[model samples]
Target chain A: MREKTTEPLVRIRGVHKSFGSLEVLKGIDLDVDQGEVCVLLGRSGSGKSTLLRCINHLEGLNDGEIHVGGERIGYERRRDHLLPMTSRQAARQRQNIGMVFQRFNLFAHRTVLENVMEAPIYVAKRPRKEVKREALELLERVGLADKPAAYPAMLSGGQQQRVAIARALAMHPALMLFDEPTSALDPELVGEVLTVIQDLARSGMTMIVVTHEISFAREVADTAVFMDGGLVVEKGPPSEILSDPSDPRTRTFLSRVLKETA
Target chain B: MASATADPIGESSLPIRKRPKLVQWALIAVLGLVVAAGAFSVVNNENFGWPIVFEYFTSPRILSGLVRTLHLTALSMAIGIVLGVILALMHMSRNRFVQSIAWAYIWFFRGTPVFVQLLFWGSISALYPKLILGLPFGGPAWLEMSANDLITPYIAAVLGLGLNEAAYMAEIVRAGIKSVDRGQSEAATALGMPDGLTTRRVVLPQAMRVIIPPTGNQLIGMLKTSSLVAVLAYPELLYSAQLIYAVNYQTIPLLITASLWYLLITSVLSVGQYYLERHFGRSEARSSLEAR
Candidate 1:
């Protein structure tokens, strides 16, 4: 096992989350260094996705702290009292972080270019001309320059997910979170979206992805965290975790994934 | 061709069994007979004179009244649509006070007869003789206008008709808005847009697909309902016909003239509605095809 480092870009400590008494994440603690691609491998409902959501404050945490780029998210210290920040304040913090949803929640009313430009113009308050220029550049980066004027409903599932990534990247976020970006796509369409993400990973973007595509995880991620039952069951380098998992649950999950892939 | 003929019958191969030819022919014949009966009665009736009908329809008073009816319908529809959108947004607002106020507005207007509301508005002087505009505290000088002086019959009719129709329009707008998926709002929020801007730019455009058909229906309904304002002697189409009949005792002829104009306008509106629906539908169809 590699020695755990003290300096990390994202630090989650003793974080707990519950949705109306149904606890989804229980006491999760993990760290990802700067520019590291960490793939969270888990079955459905294993809290891997919820943990990624917590870092951006997309999902509220019941207890503990999350820090992204060394700034605390969803929490405030007021005269020795720790308070959960209001939703608007948390949203401002979320600006430094960007998320792509499992369902590729693109704004259906907007064209591909406008979808990428919306956050920069509305949230970041960038000038319209600059935002449009940057948005087109991001679209070209995702190999979707031809779809600039296409509404989401006019794009394939894979194309829409790629546009979603461009939309997130347009903000120039410090960390990008992807929650099963290809899970909702057709099997044939999955590779196109994964290739876009793989390209992003190769370009040294800090990413935390909750994904089921084990081969992509193994090939692209620097570290892999295996989660089960709302807890991080094991954490190590991708070769160690995917090839030689220590925990029985991790081994069983790998066996199932391998069998399905084969 | 041999294989196609030998294939077992599927859902579409039930012999295209339509109504028997005799039955269809009978239906058309019955419809024609009904129309002919109507025409014969009109032609034979003592009050139904073609020359009198033409004269009454071309009369200056009746023509002016027809113009007034059309003008009122257009003005009321415009005001109703604007008010309806605002009311819809207020009804959907998260603030409890605004929602309740909107609810009360729709409730009162929809529950009461529009005629009663018009009468009440026309006689607003009986309740509040003056219209005062000022803040609760002493912020500015009060601007007072007397109800009797300012509340003209035409203004009362417009207010009554527009406000009453707005209640129905609000429901249509709410339904249109609700038809959009909840995720659209979440996606807009994720993009960090404020709620109002999200609604204006993202939500309302999509909601228009659901809103426009029902609004077109409401406009047609309002065209017919505007005739009720004649009870206040606003000199609308129906009242103009009544005034002519009261003088010349040609009741049926004048009513036929008014009916002809109303039918023409409503038919035009119906055709407009059909084309608008088709336009929206075609775009939606194209988008779904692209999605697939």
Candidate 2:
């Protein structure tokens, strides 16, 4: 085993993102250690999703640095300055980081197995036989082995999200980000997706999840972070933050969410 | 309640009737007679030259000309589709210079009449007598040829038709690319595919569902527009007919023969376009059927 170190798997320093005049993330800092499951809890428009996007460099940072596995996300670090990497270089950097969106953005034109196998075969240049076999295994893991031939439009929202997760897993990413994975699913379908994610958490994958599921967060997260209006309101163990929160904002937010779910 | 058992729920299901339209039937009858009368008069008229049209319809000269027209259409459309895709990408590009260049190209080509463009290409030697194969701005020429020799009728026709078609095709292609959801490209980007490969493998395939129908229309339109090449005295289908009629003085018959061939090809192409649209729409078709 590699020696445990103080260095985190994902490190963000004073990250700020904005769309024109409206700032989404304002000078945020955080760290996710290796093999940790960190769940971001917040209402809509609270910068949790934007922070996750910045980690994978899906959204560029206006000011700050995000490093995953000791490498900067979308920029090269020169002496005393940071220069943006070329798109090709930035794409290569994204290979190690997997992301699942709220809408479950599976390639609608691709079959389930093809979606899982796409990045491996096309981007990584893996042989078809090898990728296909592994892709089948991934489908089996997601409990979708029987529907490899099905297009995404034929699948339920929960099934599509699972396939999306498998698609991201095909790259064997070092870190995974889930942005409201079950938020779009039907109420009855949410459990299946949460179960899949809980299994992933148990398997020691380094994941940062943004979700409104308080019970799931308390069950799976090593660190539960409450964010509000582009800033982290409170950060601590799930037990402390979920049941007996310190911050008044966190208390208010949690109460509203729990009442809605209840 | 007791009588309902025999009738099985409410008055024999109301007979499932459609209202009769007396005016529609009367209009159809009148239109049919007019069409038949017109057809009979044309068939009876000796000057119409029906037999002459049939004789030259498959004549070797006319057949070869028909082949040339097909070749020109296919080649020009090939150029148009390829260059159209490139220009569409450039027009959508974030770079101001590249985007404006594409805009300028589309504006110039679409602004001018294609007939004038063809004529310009036909006498391009008047504009530039000698053509040089080298760099711009007084650079040394590696090879030189007369413009008349370099720009043959076929080449000129292809260039004129293809370049102009590309301008329209570019707009069609742009609309297609825009129709795709933004999330599709973002998902591809998240999977680590570069923008170019993502476009080819992801965006363009989805865009084809929107791009195919108008492209088919353009193809059919090109079949007829190719007749304009006759102005250059190039012997495509129409010009070939013109050649025969000029000798035999069978103007109407030869022209009729050429029209028949154009109609035939365009009809076939329209059917083909239907099948291509269905092929691209497979997934959506299946899903809609499932929904129904």
Candidate 3:
């Protein structure tokens, strides 16, 4: 039986992040349940990507707490005071969370198979034989089994992104964050990458994706969030958020995007 | 007009070829004549003592000195590369103190001439007569030795060339590390690899594409710069050649012999550099090709 817990897998309370004088994320609060796919829709500079980065502690928060898997991200409570965690501690926390980038960011020096196998063999300290077997399986699942020996530069943008997804899955992360996985892909190539992600969602993996794909979000996300100016303007099922947004800003942004896509 | 143009195009289509350049051939002919004249003047001049050059070119003493030059180049380059990598990392460190220390080292070493550094290393005993190994600020000493005994001529040469080369190498390595995309390391960090592992697995390999060409230049530069140690009477290639000319009074010939050897070594090193560039350039080739 699935364990029923009152606490969600990811919790964010009043998270704020800034770069110098410019505040990107201002007083954001959200939660994601286990095995749920949360799609964040936002225009550029709306803090969607920053919010995703904060979940994995890739960006430290200015003022707030993010708890992933019940542990405070980038901080520890010591004697009723929150203290910043050391790099080692932060790294350990990140091990349970996998992240994919907009650009493929596959290691140029490594072959596709080696890229998938690297973190498990080095960071997680898994046996090479076992990691290799799982890496090939992940590649096959992503429809890239034949291209394992090829370097990332030799692959299409779509293929490289698929390999990147496989690489993240090899870590067996409890949660995955995708920062515009198909944003950099050609329009024709975007579907293949989205299909791979859809398969992952169906497999009951917890994921938080920052993307502009309204149709994909409608089909895939359990919860759809519309964000603007560093705040969530509306949150509901994808059907409601995409079809009839309560907020005027959400309506305008969706229409703009849909018109462009159309 | 269409029919007229199409008929000629469909026919043989006039095979294209480069224009024959009467001017270029005349220029080449003149330049070749001038070069031949210069060569004939040099070969025919008795003052050059060409016979003496051929005789000492394979002399045992000069050959041994060549070997020593090779040894010094290999040893100094190894030291420069290892220390350079460390200093580059320290230069890029987050700690203010560590970063400034690396900055100071690169500044001091690069600001002054390497020749002065070599001279100082040669007469190091004059500055510090006794070497002490102990705790800082006048603590108990564990070992002691004479600086003269410790700093041999060979050690001095290695220190002079390697330490100076390291400062330049540090800058080159820093530029190389910076050339890699920020996303590369970010991806590694997101995968939970520590800073050091990310640098090793992701950053450095990509950095090598930018690092190798300049490093090969440094290696070739070091090979020639090592001849500077001959001023200390260390019996390197130039010094040994000077010793032979001093006895026979065939100065010009012996200088020519040494120049020939230097040219040969540099040529070989250039070829090696070409192959190394090709090796690290593998991944870049596809992207560049696609771009074209």
Candidate 4:
């Protein structure tokens, strides 16, 4: 059952996104309460990742609105018009939203510690001493305390993704967005990254994860959302949705993915 | 041949292979002969006047001219690189009028030959004999000065060389910026970094890897191109050589001295360029993969 009470932390109301003439998201409406781990699942090119990007303003909305932490995202409603914020103003809103990319987009030139400490020190304008202490603590939490000084290029793909997670957490954002975080990792390496994410979920960190790792989704996701063709086909608790999905498209996708792994 | 003969040490049943590198030996022998013949011709030719080249290479006139040449190159390159960076940013501006203005400046400077441009600058007084520091056309003048007094050969050379080099450097800088991946800028922006900070800290530092080598080449080219100012009679290295050879009728030796100096400076620049490339490219600190 979907939890729809007590002020949803993320509320998407009739959000529509299109690129040129092609509609990527058509009226996506959903809600996640505080501390809810919502796993977005779908086949390739089904607009799951696009929806996640829209939440962060990496993609613009064609119509409707999204609210995160009770504030309008990407656009400001002034006198019945959805006026877009300036790039600088839009960046300020992203400070509350941490995004982990599929490729782990860690700054290749900076050491692991610097990568985590960058946004906190430079963007947030925090004092270096306090930020350094917390950043080191984050690295230790991510099991990379020894690699604080190692550059991104020196670490494995899994380790880099872990550092990216640490970097995002250093901001202490209210909500985190994971765009197929482990999809780019090697099969064996994916476990390491997924383990760290599971720990985050257990600690009640609010997250919207877009992933194809069905088992990980089942284990950690409080709610499972299956989207297809720019719309959410079905959404329910992971236990109910994974075993007995009502939508035909969702069933077909799950069967194919599960068969591949088996 | 070495790989073909090599086999696993424990697998003793493999055949002992034999290979001869006759083709490589023959090529090396021919290359050695060509080197010997070329060196013999250059050393034996008395028209080169090796003794005269050695004697005047360090002459006070030549040395002063070399100093002037280096000074002109440094000033012109600094002006070019600074203006070039600004023009590149302007070219990438979202405003069409700004982009067009930058484009027009590049077109005008690059369309004309540097030699012709230097000549034009040298003869600027003929076009406008008097320059007035004033308001718009026909307005009251704040100050008036004769163009010939203001635009000496030295000033003309600096303007000509610096302005012309700026056009090429602008294109080089733009290309370097374009070479960076779009994801880099997106990540920086998503991290809430302001545009100016992102460009300076993230974009430019990464773009430096691409920008440095071509910029080094331009520096060396500017050192050689400073010679074009000779037509303005500015007394740079080539002009000084011409002045020396004109009086003594020793054109070839003096020219050789100038060429050798240019080569030596360029060699030093290449070494510095190599180190800069290594510093940026090999920045990743080594930490071996840890045990699981």
lDDT of 3 by residue, A128-240 (tens): 99999999999999999999888888889999999999999999999999999999999999999999999999999999999999999999999999888999889888999
DockQ values of all predictions? 0.44, 0.75, 0.71, 0.42
Error of 3 at B75 (Å): 1.1
For candidate 3, list the clashing residue pairs, or say none.
none
Report the error of model 3 at residue A13, Å.
Answer: 1.1
lDDT of 3 by residue, B70-162 (tens): 999999998898889889999999889999999999999999999999999999999999899998798999999999899988989999999
What ranking emerges by DockQ with the best candidate at the front?
A: 2, 3, 1, 4
**Candidate 1 lDDT for residue A194:** 95
Candidate 4 structure quality by residue, lDDT tens digits, B8-72: 47766766777989999999999999999999999899999999999999999999999999999
- Tens digit of per-residue lDDT, candidate 2, span B126-197: 999999999899999999999999999989999999999999999999999999998888999998999898
- Rank the models by TM-score, top first: 3, 2, 4, 1
Please give the lDDT score at residue B135 for candidate 1. 75
DockQ of 4: 0.42
Q: Indicate which candidate wins on TM-score.
A: 3
Candidate 4 off by > 4 Å: A1-6, B1-34, B132-134, B140-145, B284-292
Q: What share of the reference contacts survives in each candidate?
A: 0.32, 0.58, 0.72, 0.43
Between candidates 3 and 4, the one scoring higher on lDDT is: 3
Poorest lDDT segment (10 consecutive residues) of candidate 3 chain B: B4-13
Candidate 1 global lDDT = 0.87
Interface RMSD of 4: 2.9
The better candidate by DockQ, 1 or 3, is 3
